[model samples]
Target: MARKRGLGRDDVVTAGLAVLDHAGIDAVSLAAVAERLDVRPPSLYAHVDGLAGLKRDLAHTTTVEFGEVLRDSVLGRSGPDAVRSFADAYRRWATGFPGRYEMTLLPIAADDDERRAGARLALGAVQAVIRGFGIDETSAIQAGRSLRSALDGFSRLENADNMGRGDHDADFAFLIDLLIDGISQAGTQPPGPA
Candidate 1:
């Protein structure tokens, strides 16, 4: 109970993530994390402000972690290939860590710079795909929003086992192809008279 040598904020975050993985978001409490770390609850206050602070940290950490997953997935890919890789990476992460994935969507204030940047990093992955499609800045924002929404909706449904029983893998592949095709066509479309 001597502060557990080498224990730090990252350790707390890792412990919290473990709790999240095993028992869901609601199970991630200071006491739970402390217990996981073999320390008392008050000891956690030294590493994290409190439950709210811990959750905030967890949100930022997980957002970045999710973004890293995305970025890594498309490291050598571009265009429709990046799109497919991004989609596959996202679904795998969402389904693998449903609790943490939900935390990524939690509402946070705009002033939360670290959290905002982490979230943006994840979105940046999608923007990379949009960029591959040659979409301009004006169109990229809208395109990113649509792609994120579609991916989130599909992942949530698929994670909840609500995607029906007709080979979900194929369903996801088809969905990705449809998204890529849509983006490809949009890129080729002549701009409307303006």
Candidate 2:
């Protein structure tokens, strides 16, 4: 077998993601990634802190990639259009990389810059969509949370093959429509007596 001497941090992360894609997140371990790379687990310590650090790095990578896909999805779009685009793109990203998507949900420590950057990028897209509705920051935050929760929930169910025989596309579109209508209605309402 050829030597794995030049393997770097990225190589480890890439191997980890491949392991995830093939065997799900639970199967991703330092040993598994090292095995995929034909190297000993201890060799990975040069690139990653260990299993936990590998997971965090995977989360950071997937989140950043997801955010970029989201940002691109909403380009030149706003309001309901942007919302729909965002939802569609989000579903695409999540479903395409369900294992990696799960990684993005891993907890990030306070000082984790990569995780923070990835999260901020994803949130910025949502914030932009909310602002397009003329929603204030306080309300936008709530809206963002609601939108994310809905999207994530649906995607998780679908990724798990648990949509229960429903017409998945129709159900997703219906949810997206409901979300858009709610945001639009909220935008048209006056602030509660301040």
On TM-score, the leading prediction is 2
Model 2 off-target regions past 4 Å? 192-194
Model 2 per-residue lDDT tens digits across residues 109-161: 89898789988888889988888999755667778888999999999999988
lDDT of each: 0.86, 0.88
TM agreement with the true structure for every prediction: 0.89, 0.93
Backbone clashes, each candidate: 0, 0
Model 1 TM-score is 0.89
List pairs with backbone clashes in candidate 1: none
Which residue pairs collide in model 2, if any? none
Error of 2 at 37 (Å): 0.7
